[model samples]
Target: MADKQDLNAGFTGTPVEQPEGLAKAAQSAASRVKREAYAVTAGARDHPHTASALLLGIGIAAFGFGYLLGRSSAESSASYWR
Candidate 1:
């Protein structure tokens, strides 16, 4: 078996260090997303009826869009022998 150092000896690239600002930026962005998600959850919990209505509307729209798309595609490839 080859040693670990022997295996790594093939690559001579230097290690790259991440910027301090990049780490801070990532942490801030993650925290912001977490806060926003918590707020959305709280809002939905407080307004269950609104959230349900919104979900229903989105579902209906999605179904209609899918039906239209499928119908259009099917028409384009329809057979004339029927």
Candidate 2:
């Protein structure tokens, strides 16, 4: 345990070497993400009606789910048996 601690304490904080291929892969992934994001944004901007309908549908679904959960919990917690 003492030797392990000494070994850990003697190490200098030097950065580890990374392969160039990893950097290239990361950049390619980032480029693809940026392109996809731009496409989505452009599509949304071009089709406001579709985007608004989707947003409204999602909101209504979320509200309905929350309302059901709240009602279930309230019913379960009530002392009807007593």
Error of 1 at 75 (Å): 1.2
- Write one digit per residue (lDDT tens) for candidate 1, span 1-82: 9987668656577548654798879978999999999999999999999999999999999999999999988887786435
Compared to the true structure, candidate 1 yields what TM-score?
0.61
Compose the digit string of candidate 2's lDDT tens values, residues 1-82: 4675566656587548753798879978999999999998899899999989999999999999999999998898786755
Give all candidates' CA lDDT scores: 0.88, 0.87
Best by TM-score: 1
| Model 1 misplaced regions, further than 4 Å | 1-22, 79-82
Q: Report the error of model 2 at residue 25, Å.
A: 8.4
Clashes of 1: 0
